[model samples]
Target: MFSGLPQDYSSITVTNDGWWPDTDVADFQSQRSIPASIKTETVASALLMAIGEANAELAAYQSAQRAKGFSSAKDVTGPSAGGVNQLCAQYLKIIFARAKAELMGEITSAEREKANPGQQSEDTRDRLLAEASFAIRNIMGHPRVTVDLI
Candidate 1:
């Protein structure tokens, strides 16, 4: 319940569909503690952007998986939760973190507008992005960092 206001059923819906796992707006909001003031459209936009970015980042890995007879992320063998693929879970983490980071500024503004007055620090957003990057690397079976002699 947000500010005791009536819920926007429409906003609870995910605005886009794609080849990757579908993003549940309601789930994202709940898991990330998104306020109603941020509007579903804003969140959906951020999600779409994050999906695009993640897809772009994973293109090569996806291709390799396809070459190995896995047509989609879901087809790749991995640990499963409630039958959900681990890769799918990690992909959700990537998008959720990216989307939340993208909304940090709007979240702060919305909080201030609602008289909540809590600041969303840059460090928080950076951490969210780092989480996304970590998830990406995890799915890719790559280390979180690389070192090279210069």
Candidate 2:
């Protein structure tokens, strides 16, 4: 395990292997073509929307749990809370992965000259970071839950 590593170590590596590939321009061009109808900005916006919705749902679920008095009366650090958080985290992770894949598709399409070829479009890194920021804001903006125990 990474017992002694700094907490910031977790933030250092963000890219997933499946999100992108190392291929030459010709190979990338030949393998897949970008859809003519889709724009990079549209793709980035869609990703932001999806991540925002997922994060909002997660925050709502957490707030509901807290409002039920279950979070206050019982040990929130117990197995159940941990399990729920893990499940939600996994869901968020999948959302992020899908977003990354979609951004990759846009990049590949653009690079292949299928849609916005030869144009300086938004790169994958910028798109992912934008979506992440949107997700973070969505989560933080949710109303906090309060529990009343009789």
Top-lDDT structure, candidate number = 1
How would you encode candidate 2's per-residue C-alpha lDDT over 12-42 as one tens digit per residue?
2222222111112222122223232354455
Q: Score each candidate by Cα lDDT.
A: 0.81, 0.42
Question: Which residue pairs does candidate 1 place in steric collision?
Answer: none
Which pairs clash (backbone N, Cα, C closer than 3 Å) in model 2? none
Candidate 1 residue lDDT tens string, 80-110: 9887899988999999999999999888887
Question: What is the overall TM-score of model 2 with all chains considered together?
Answer: 0.29
Regions more than 4 Å wrong, model 2: 1-47, 68-85, 110-150
